[model samples]
Target: MQLTTFTDYGLRMLMYLAAQPEQQCSVREVADHYGISRNHLVKVAHRLSQLGFIDSTKGRGGGIRLSGEPASMRLGDIVLKLEPNMHIVECFDKSTNCCAITAICKAKDFFRQANQAFIDVLNKYTLSDTIVSGKSFLEIFALPQPTNPDRHKQS
Candidate 1:
């Protein structure tokens, strides 16, 4: 049940922004910090901005910042917005699925249940919860941090 790279990067970008809500960030900075492509981050940033997750500014001294509070941003909702499709199996998309056993397949029900369970877990945590939970997540996972500490100092 792996998510696409688009969704993966989208979530990462959101987490980064949520962690430093007091400051604005740029796609180049985030991409360099994460060792990812700036082009990809730009596309993700554009989509996120369009979806009302982040606000963008142009020209000198301009950057992107979160449009809303992190506590109100649900992980499940973000995933659903970033991911173009969530079908785990061919039968999940009835419009294109021509599976012969889709009508009576118990596996389809199991898959549906599994997907729901996955979403349920994500729904339990919001961006604020991830940061405020006080858990040791940094040690377990390697994530990006701003090179310039002052870049995120409260304005």
Candidate 2:
């Protein structure tokens, strides 16, 4: 199932925030780094904040940040909240199902299972999981690299 642009931008915003846990990130910063629409990102940020996924503050020195630890934010849970419809087939939604064979079509069951499987895999991962190779991820945003706590000791 293809995710909508809304979901894509939301996930990008989350990933960017997850990578910069120590500071408040602006919507413009995130949007500029990704070369996406800042206007669109604003809507996603508002929804994310409303959903308690991120915290937002306005005015001077104000921006957005993840409300929870990245490790605790499951990818599947985020997707479920951001994605309006998860139906993989036309028959999935009873109200919208117009396919004649929906009643007898075993295809619905198969598609349902496929959709669940997709979510199950995502459930196994968290926002932190997405930033596993965070050095590269950080570089993309032109943000300062996180100083390794053990760096001084190593030297």
lDDT of each: 0.83, 0.88
In candidate 1, the residue pairs with backbone N, CA or C atoms under 3 Å apart (3 or more residues apart, or in different chains) clash, namely none
What local lDDT does model 1 show for residue 56?
A: 95
Report the lDDT tens digits of candidate 1 across residue range 1-155.
98988898888888777777878989897786676779989999999999999999988998998899999998988888888579999999989999999888899999999988988889888888767432343232355544666643667
lDDT of 2 by residue, 23-134 (tens): 7989999988877779989999999999999999999999999998999999999999998589878787889889998768887888888988888999999999999665
Model 2 — TM-score against the truth? 0.87
- Off by more than 4 A, model 2: 142-155
Deviation in angstroms for 39 in model 2?
0.4
RMSD, one per candidate, in order: 8.1, 10.1
Global lDDT for candidate 1? Answer: 0.83
**Most accurate candidate by lDDT:** 2
Q: Tally clashing residue pairs in candidate 2.
A: 0
